[model samples]
Target: MDNNNQTLATNELATLPLGHNWYQKVASNFEIIQSYLNKLDTDEPEANNLKNKFDNMSDKLNIYETNIQAIVNILSDYDVPIAIVDGKVVEIKEGD
Candidate 1:
């Protein structure tokens, strides 16, 4: 888009009311910023480094989510109540 159109779109986005769906608004804004960054010259070394960092962060997030799910599954296997204390998962005993 031309500079005029880009400015108009940005102005419209700025005018949006941040209320109940504020998270969706912020996510869309991030998408717009990512699109702009993706349009940059890929041959630039700094851009490559930034892309790598983003990739690494994405991978780490995935790993963290997977581990959390695994912990949830393991905890769900037992019928007793469990609690996390001092970074450890312990089963709750009756009348304790």
Candidate 2:
């Protein structure tokens, strides 16, 4: 309802766990598909196409993982109340 309340709510939401588990599951699935593609006979043109698709998917997944890690790092820094702990800002309790 107020600025402090809004800030606290935002901080709480920001600290929620990112979907690392989901990303890992999708990545694992991609690995399985790629393995299957590799075992297939290379003479078939469709095999090549499927392998290429898997390669592109792997690359994009890597990029996504990196970006997610960066976001998590940034959020980890924000979770620490550095300004308040360092005495740069005082946190006033209600009724104080």
Per-model lDDT: 0.65, 0.56
**How many collisions between residues are there in candidate 1?**
0
Residues 30-81 of candidate 1: C-alpha lDDT, one tens digit per residue: 6666666666754488878889999999999989867866685677676456
> Candidate 2 on 1-96: residue-level lDDT in tens?
112221222334445568535555455556666655565655578877889999999999989867766665565476632223342244444454
TM-score of 1: 0.40
Q: Which regions in candidate 2 have their CA more than 4 angstroms from the true location?
A: 1-43, 80-96
**Model number with the top lDDT:** 1
Total clashing pairs for each candidate? 0, 0
Error of 1 at 19 (Å): 54
Off by over 4 Å in 1: 1-43, 80-96
